[model samples]
Target: MSGTSEGQGPAGVAVPGSIRPSVTERHNFGRTASELRDYRAAFNAAQLAMAVVDHRGLVISANEALAALLGTRPTELRDRYAADLIDLASDARTWHAYREVLRGRRSRFRCTRRLKHPDGRALWAEVTVSPVPESGTVLLSVADISDRRELRARLRHLQMHDPVTRLPNRTLFFERLTAALESSPYDQGSTGRIGLCYLDLDGFKAVNDTLGHRVGDRLLAAVATRLAECADAGGPGHGGGHLVARLGGDEFAILVEDSTGTEQLADLARSVLAALQEPFDLAGQRLSVSASIGVVERAVSGTSATGLMQAADTTLYWAKEDGKSRWTLFDPERNAHRMTRQALSSMLRPAVERGEFTLEYQPLVGMADGVTRGVEALVRWNHPQFGTLTPNRFVAIAEEDGSIVQLGQWVLRTACRQARQWQLDHPDVPPLFVSVNVAVRQVWDSDLVADVAEILAETGLPAHLLQLELTESAVMGSAGRPLQALQALSDMGVHIAIDDFGTGYSNLAYLSRLPVSVLKLDGTFVRGFQDEAHANPADETIVQALVELAHRLGLTVTAECVETSGQASRLRRIGCDTGQGWLYSRAVGPDRIAEMLGAGPRPQAAAASG
Candidate 1:
C-alpha cells in the first residue's frame, strides 16, 4: 500500500511529515521491524474484514478476510473505489456521510448495507470507516450481520401475525394504519385519503361454543383465505394493495391507502360480506356465517388512526343493529345523533342526583261528564345543556344503564307527595289522584311493591288514589316476580293501569286473570277519531271492543290522546270511562291542575288557549 506522507487531521488541515506519527509509533507501538511483520500477519488473519483506503476513497490494501468476504482476490480489490466495493453510494445520506469521513470532516462513519457476494448471495454487513493515525488513510471494517438480521425478521413476522390464520394481527394493523396517517403529503405517489372496512363474523361465538375451538380455528383459517382474496381484488387505484389483518377473534380489518372514495370502500365491504356468506365446509360441519361491516373513507389530513377506528367501530355496530349480514357507511348526521345520545346516557345518573327532573300532570277526565277524574304524572328533564327533554329522549338510556331504578324511585316519591299535598290543599273539590308511569325494569330491578308501600306511607297518601301506569307490553307478559309484584300492589288498593293498551299483545283472556284495574287505549286508535267525518269505524270498533272487554273484566277504560271535542263526544258515546289528552290540556304544572279542579270541566277552547 502507498500513500502521501502528509496527513490531514479531523479539522481538514494538512499535517506536515515532520509532525506526522511514524509507522512504528502508530502501528507497532515503537516495536522492531520483525514485530511489525507480526502485526501485518495478525491483520491478515483477523476474522473481521478490514481494508486500507486513502483520502481519495480508493482502496490501497485489503486483508485476506475482506477478500474472502467479498468473494474476490486481494489483488482484485486493490485500487478499487471503497465506496463502490461496499455500495456506500446507494443512497444520498450514506454517500454524504462516507464523503465526510474521507474528507477528514467526520470522526468516523458507520452504517448497515446489503452486499452481494461474487457467488450471488446477499449478505447484510455492518460497515464502519475510521481514520488510520497520521496516514491520511482510513481503515474500513465490515462485519457479517445477515444471521442477526434474518433472526430479527423472523421474530417480527411472528409478532405481527396471527398464528392460526397466518394473517397480520392487530399490532401490525395499527402500525400500518398509523404510518399511513403519518405519511407526508409531499411523499411520492402519496394519496391524500384513506379508507377501511372493519367487520366481524356474526354468531361466531355460537360457532366456537357448539363446534369446539379446533373446528372454529379451521373455519377462521378458511375465512381468512377468502378475506385475503377480497383484499387483493379490491386494492386501491394506485395498485398499492389493501392490508388485511385479523384484529383478534372474529374481528378483522382491511385498510386501503390512497383510497379513491366511499364507493371504493363500499365495494370492498360488499365483496367481503358476499365472500363470507358462502358456507364453510370444515370437517363436514358445513358451518354458515355472515359478517357486519363498517366502511369509513375520508381525507387523511384531518383524522388520526384512533379517530378513524372509532368511526369504523361505531358504523360496524350500526350494521349489526340494523341486522347482521350487511354493511353500513358512516353518516355524519347519524353519528351526531349517536353522540348526543351517548352524552345524555353518560350524564343520566348524575342528572338524577342533581335533581334535574320534574313532573307534569295530564288530566284523565270522565268520558260521561267531561269532569276531571285524576291526573297522570309525566316526568320531564330540565337538562342544563339541552334545555327541557321529554321522557322519550332519555328514558331508554336510563333503562339501559339501570339508572331508571333511581329515577323511578324519585318519580314515585315526588308524585305521591304531590298528590297528598293536592288532596290536603283542595278539601272542597274532589280529591285528585296522581297516576305515575312505571318502567318494567323498575319492577324487576327494585322491590316495586315495597317501594310503592314506603312512598305511600311516607307521603301519607292512600294507595287507592295513586295509580301506577305500565305499558301494555310490559304487563301482558307478567310472571314470576313481576306478577307477584303486580298482585301485591293491586291488593294494596293502588290501581294497575295498562298504558298504551290495544297496541301490544292485547291478551283479553290474560287481562281477566291479572289484577289490573284500568286500560289506557293507545294514541294511534284515538288519532283516528280526530273528527266525526274522518273517524274510521274500524278504529272505533277496535276501541269499542277493547272498552267492552275491559268493562266485562271489571276494569275501566281511559282513552288517550283525545285531541278534539268530536273525538271526546264519540269516546263518551262509546262508554270510554276516562279520557286523557290535549283535548283537555297538555301536561301542566300542579297549579294548572288545581285551577282545573276548581273551575269545573275545561271549556272546548281552553286547552287550545293554554
Candidate 2:
C-alpha cells in the first residue's frame, strides 16, 4: 500500500486501479484472474443494460442499467430467467432462436422486444445475446430503443393509412387482400370467397363545389366512422373479418375475407347504401350524400387481387351509368364483353395509324329502273388480329376516343378517289354517286367543309358525285358551329343526306331548316314491310307519311334494307326514290363493285335474301 497510488473514496475508503501496479506487472502477479475481474469494472458501469447468464438461460448477474430497465434492483434480477424478464417467448421465432442459443447451436443473435417492468408497464428494448468465449456462460445486452421504434411505427402508420379519414389506404388494402387470398384454403377446390364493395360518393364533387372542401373533409370523416361501425356491427352478410379503407377522394372500400356468398356481398352493398342515405350533420350544415357501390365476390383461389379490383372498378362505372345510389354485382359475362370492347377501343387509334381500315360499297338502286344509281361507302376495319370487323364493333370506340375524325377523313378520301376511278374507267353512260357516313364528332371537331373541299379537289371528283350523310339526331337541329359546318359543306356543291331518319328526335319542325337533300329511311320500317306475315300495316302508313312529308320538304326519300322485290314494290308505291340493303348486295369491295358495274344492271332477284 505504501508503494501504490490510490484515490480517496467515501469515508476515506481506498479504491483500486489508482492503487494498482502496472497492468503488465499486475498480470504477471499470481492474481492474473483478478486482473480480468478488474477488466469487468467498465462493463458493470456501462450505461447499456447488461447481464451474465448461464447456459440454462438464467441470469447469473445484472448491472444497474439492467435492473433499471426491469424496474427492479440488481439483486432481485439475479436468478430470474431472461425469458421471464423480456417476455421473449411471445414470438415463436425468437423463442426458437433462444433455444438454439442455449443448445450452443448458434453463437449470437440480436432482436428488438418488449420487456415487462416491475410496475407492469412495457419497455421496448433492443437486445443482443452472445456466447462468452471459452466460457459456458452467455452475455446479454439491452438498450431502450422505444423512441426510434415509436418513430418508425409512426412513419409506417402515416405511409399505410389515409390522412383525411385515417383509414387503411390503397396500398395497405392491396397488401391485406393479397394476404387473404394467399392464406385461403385452396386445396378444397372451392376456396372461401372474398368479397369487396367498392364505393364512390355520388355527386360528392357537387358538395365540394357548393360547400368548401373543409366541410367535404368532415363529411368524409363522418362517413368513414359510419362505415367502420357498419363493418364491426356485422350488417347483412358480414361473417367476421371486415376492413374499411379509404381508396382516395370520395371513394372507399370494404373487404370481406371468407365471404359467405354473393347474397352476403349484395347485402353488404345494400347496408352501405342505406347507411349513406342518411344525411350527415357536418359543420352546422345538414347535407345529404349517397354512394354507388360495386360489389364483386369470387373464389379466392383463381382470382388475383388486381383482377378483383379491376372487375370492381368496372362494375362501379356501371352503377354510375345506370343511375345513382345503387349497387351492381360483378357479371362475368358482361365483364368479358366489355373487356373486348375496351380492348378494341385501345386498338382503334393504332389501327387507323397502321392503315388497317378499308371501304366496301353497297348499291342504292333507282326504284323504277332497278338500276344502281349510287353506292354507300361503308367502312370496315381490316384488323390483323381480329380479322374483318364491322362498324358496330369498332365505330363507337373510335367516336369515343376522338379517332373518328381521322377515320372518317380516311373513308371520305378513299371513297372519293374510288368514285373518280370509276368515272375514268367507264367513260360511263351514267355517273353513280358515292355516299359517305359522317359522325357527330367529325362534324363538330374537324373542319368538315374544308376536309370535303380538299378531298374532292385532290381526287378530281365532282362534289355532286359524293354525298355526306349524317344521323338524324346529328342533323335535326342546325345551330351555331355544327349548323354552320353543314351549311358550308352543302354550299360547296356537296349532296347532304339524313341517314337513319326519324329514329331520333322527330322534331319535324326543325327539319325544314337543314341542308339535307335525301332522307334515308331506317331499315326497321322496311323490314317490317318485307312480307305481309310480319308486316305491320301501321308501318306502311308510317312509310307513306314519311315519304309524303319528305317530298313536301323537297327531300328525296330512299327506303333502306329492302330484301325482296315485293318490299321494293311496296317502297316504290310509297314514292320512295331509291332502295339499298343486302336485298341488292351485301357491301362489296371496290374491285367487286367495278365488276358489278361492267356486268350490266343485275335486276333484283325475285325473292332476294333478306
Candidate 3:
C-alpha cells in the first residue's frame, strides 16, 4: 500500500480495480500531507493549547503549545480525554456540548472554560472544537483571553466613574436607574415615576480660584463620598433606591426610583445640602461649599431620558439664579420662558443685522436748572414675532454670546449720529451728551477708543458730547491695557461716566483715579431717600457723604430713579447735579427727544425739584 501509484497498486494489495486515479489526485495527497505537517508545526509553536482527539474522545496527539497552556508536559497529556482537563464541577454543560460534537450531532463547539494549570493556577480559555471525520479525529483549539478581558474591565471603569471625584458618572447612574425602575414593587399607579435631584456647588469657582486645582480636586472627591453616604442613608426602603453621579464640573445628579411624590425628593435634596454644609479639609486647608438643588418628579408617561435631563438642567439654572443653596422644582411655565429667551438670544445677531433694533433716548435732566442736560441712549428691540423688547431682556444675553461688541458699536454710531442731529436741531439747549452703556467684554475685546473716535469723527459730533456709561464693576475690573484704553478715550475728549454705582466693590480710592467725569448713583440709594424718615439715618448720611465726596473730587453726581417730586427734592438737597429716571420722562424715540428739546424745557415739578 505504501508503494502504490495513482494508476497501479501492489500485486498482493486488494485494490479497487474500477477506480483509476490521475496524476492530479496523487499530487493532491502529497500537498495535503505537507499542509498538515505545516499546520501541526505552527500549532505546536503557538502559545495557545492545541490537540487532536479520536472519535472515542481520547486525546490522540497533543502539541507542546497545549502542554505549556496546561502547565504540563505533552507525554502526560497523550491519550487523555479532553474533558478531564476542564473543571467539570463548574462547567458540566460545556462538557455535554463537546460530547454532542463527538456524537455527530454538532460539527463544532465553542465556549469559555476554566482549567487548573500544573502550577495550580486557575486559568480561563475561549475554546473551539471541530470534528475531522476524514482523519477520524476531533480538533480542539484554545486561546487565553485574560488580558483582553482585563482591558475591557478597565475601559468600563473609566466610562462609568468620574476621574476627579471617583464617583459614578451619568452612564452608571442611568444604568442603576433603569434597573430600579424595572425592579419589583414598582410605583403604585399605571403612571410610575422617578425623581432626580440635580445640584450645583455654589462658590466652588471661588475655591478653585483661591486654592489650586489639586486642592479643588481633592475637595470634590471628599464631597462625592459624602454625597454617596447621604444616598445610602436614604436607600431602597425609603422609596426604591438612590443613586448619585458626578455630572461634570461641580454638578451632581441623584436618581431616586419609585418616588412617592416630590416630598421625598425634597427631603433628599435637603439631606444632600446638609451633607455638603460640613467643611472639608483638603491639603491642610479647610474649605466650605454649598449646593443648590433642582428636584423634579415625573410620571414615566410623557417623559424620556433626554427630556428628563433637559428639565433637570433648566431647573438647575433656576436654582442658581433664585439665590444659591436652595432647591427649585421643574415648572412648565418657567421652562417655556427660558425657551423663549433662548430663542431670542439665538436670534439677536440676525435681528440686529435685519434692522430689528431701534434706539430710544431717556433725558438726563440738570437738577439745578431743570434743563435736559443729555439723553442716555437705550436700545429697544422690535422683534418680528415677540414685539418690543427692552434692554433688560437681551443685553446680558448679547454680552454672553459676544454679540455685544457689534451691538455696542451700533449703539455708539447711532447715538453719536443722533447727538449730532440734536446739536444741529436744538442749538439753544446746552450741547446734549448722549450717554451709551459699554459692556465689559466690549471694552476688553475691541479697540473701544478707536471705535469712539471714529464714530465722533464720522458723525461730526464733539467727543465730549458723546458720553460712555460704564458700570463701576466693569471699570474697576479693567487691567493695565484696558486702563490705558480708557485713558486714551479720555484723552480723545470722550466723557466717561461710571453708571450703576454703589452696587459693586466700591473702592473710592480706585474710583477717584479712573478717567471718568460723572458718577451716576445707583437707584437703590435714591430710592432710600423716599423712605428716609423711617429708614436708617446712616442711609441718608451715606448718600450725603457720597454727594460731598463726588463734589470734592470735582466729579458730577447724577441721582438715578427720581420717581417723584419728593425724591427729587431730597436729591437736590443732597447736591446731586443731575437726575435720571421716570420723573422727567420714560425713554422715547429720537424724534420725540428732538421734539422735547424743541418744546423749550417743558416745566415739570419733578425735574425742577432735583
Candidate 4:
C-alpha cells in the first residue's frame, strides 16, 4: 500500500490478469508483444502452484494452478496475502523467513506447511519464496507433498513401535527416557524425578518352547493391552501418565516421567503385578504367567538413562534370585555392596600374582597339656585400598571366578614352607603341624593330589605336618573325582581334617569310610560353652557325643573358638584333643607362634586355658 501506483488495485495488490501485462512491460523491456503473450501463456499452463507476491506480501497475480491448490478461483485469490492463503503464517519461524524474502533481505525461503482445504481435506505443501530482482515482487511456488509425508509418517510409526504388542519399541523408549532425564524441573511438574519398572515375564520362555511363538505373541499383545490401560490411569493428567514399551522378547518397561516418589512407583509396580496375575486365554489356550519387576525411582539431576536402567536390571536380578513373581525396589546400599564384591572379584587373580596375600597362624593347642601343638594357617589379603581383608571378604569372590585354585596353591606352599622352617628353627620342641583350609573348588578345578605332593616335596615338610582342612559341606558327599582326590591325598601320608565339623551334611556314617584323621568342631558349639551357669547343656552334650564318636573312629577332635578357661576345661573333659581360639592367641605372625612354641619365653594364655 505504501508504494501503490494508479493502475494497482486496492491495498496495492493488483488484479490477477491485469497485473501480468504490467509485470511483463516493466521487467521485460526488449520483449515484443508476441513474446510477452507467450510468456504469460507458459506461466498460466505451469502445473506447480505459482503466485506473484508484491512487496507488501499481497498476491499481485495468482495462476489457475495456485488457485486450485488453495481450493479457490484465481480472481478470488488476487489482492489477498499469499502467506495467509497457504497457511505459511501459522508457524512463526516460517512466517519470519517469508517476510525476509519479501523484503529482499534473504535470497530465498523454503519450508513445508500443512493447510486445510475448503473441501474438508488436509494438504501438505512444500512452499518456496524467492525475490525477483527489479520487479519489486517475489515468486511463491508450492508443491503438494501430502502423499510423501503420509508415507514417511507411516515408516516412522513402524520404526518406533513393536508390531506384536503395538506399543513403543526399545528405540522410542530410550528416546523418551533420555529426554525425560534431560528435561528441566519446571518442565516435569513439581518433582523432576524419573521412575522405571523393568519387567520380565517369568516362565515366558517355557510357553515359547512348548506352545510355540504364535501363542507367545498373542499373550504379549494381551499383556500390552492391559498395561496400556493401566498406563492410561497413571498417565498424563492423572499421576503423570507412564509410557509402556516392549523392549524385545518378553521384557517390557514402564517409564514414569515427573514421578512423585518411591511410593507412587511402588503402587504402580504392585498394580502391574496384580494385573498380570489373571490367567490369559489366547486362542483358547489358557495360560498363567507371572512377572518379576524391578522398580527404581530417583531424581533426574544426577541420574542418566543407562545408570537408572542398570539399577533396575540389578534389582530385577535380585527379585529373580529371591524367587520369581515378585517386585523389588532398588537399594543403593545393596547395590554398593554388589559393586564392591564385583571389584574384589576382578582384583582377586591379579592380587595373587602381585603377592598381596599373606598368612597368619592361630595356635591349635593341645587340650590336655595346654601347650601349642599345631597352628591353623589363615589367609589374609593386604589390599592396597581396603586394608587387611579377611578371607570372608574375598574368598567367595575368588571361588566364583576360579582364581581360588591359584590362590589355594599359594597358601599350601607358603604354609608348608613356614611349617618346615619352624621345625628347623626349634629342634627341641615337637614339630608343629600347620592346618590350611582348602576350598572345594581347589579339588574340582585343579589337580589337588599333584599340587599337594609338589608343595610337600618342595618345602621338605612331611604330609603329616601339613594338614589340609576342608569344611563339612565340601568333604561330605564326595564321589568320583573329588573322592579320588581325597583318597590319593590321604594315601600320601597327609592328615585330612573336616573343618567346621557339625555345620553341614553331618553324615556321620560316611566319615569312617573316608580317610579323615581329625574333626575341627565348628566355633558355634564352643561359643555356647560359657561359664558353668551360662553354659548350654545341649551344646556340651553334643560336643561330648561327637568327641566320643571321633575317638571310637580313631579321629582327633579339635574344638574351635575356645575363648575362656571354663570352655577349654569343658572341651577337655569331653575328650577333645585340641583347642583353637582366643583362649591361646588371635591369628598372629610366624614369629609370635614361635614364641608360643618356646622359641622365647611364652606369652601367657589369654584365659590361662588351652
**lDDT computed for candidate 2:** 0.86
Candidate 3 — which pairs collide? 367-610
TM-score winner between 1 and 2, please give it.
1
Tens digits of per-residue lDDT for model 3, 89-194: 2566877888888777888998877666677777678888898876768888887877777788899999899999888897897788666556555445433778
lDDT of 3 at 372: 83
Write model 2 residue lDDT over 1-610, tens digit each, in one string: 4455566543343546445547775445536455566657767788999998898899998998888887878899888899878777888999999878877889998898876667787778898988888778888999988789889999999999998999999899999999988884664543378899999999899989999899989999999988888787674334445989998999999998877789878877888888888988886899888989889998887889889999999999999999979999989899988988888888888887898999999999888877888899999998887799999898888889898998999999999999999878866336679999999899778988899999999999999898889998888865899888888888888989999887998887777888888999999899888676777899999999989998999999898898898898888888999999877888999999898777753444323421
lDDT of each: 0.90, 0.86, 0.83, 0.89
Error of 1 at 560 (Å): 1.2
Structural similarity to truth (TM-score) of each candidate: 0.89, 0.83, 0.63, 0.89
Deviating ranges (above 4 Å) for candidate 1: 1-31, 45-47, 65-73, 103-106, 186-188, 237-240, 600-610
Looking at model 3, residue 434 earns an lDDT score of 90
Q: For each candidate, how many residue pairs have backbone atoms clashing (under 3 Å)?
A: 0, 0, 1, 3
Q: Estimate, for each residue in 47-121, the C-alpha lDDT of model 4 and write its tens digit.
A: 989989999999988888988887778889889988788888887898899999988899999998887777889
Off by over 4 Å in 2: 1-50, 56-58, 62-96, 99-107, 113-126, 132-136, 141-159, 184-191, 235-240, 601-610
Candidate 1 lDDT by residue in tens digits, 1-610: 3555786543354555556567755544334456767878988899999999999999999999999998888889989999999999999999999999999999999999999877899999999999988889999999999999999999999999999999999999999999999998668787788999999999999988998999989999999999999998877543539999999999999999988789899888888888999988997889889999999999989899999999999999999999989999999999999999999999999998999999999888988877787899889999999999999999999999999999999999998998888888776566778899999999999999999999998999998998999998999999999999999999999999999988899888899779999999999999998786787999999988988888988999998888989999999999999998888889999888777666652444355455
Model 1 lDDT on a 0 to 1 scale: 0.90
Tell me how many residue pairs clash in candidate 3: 1
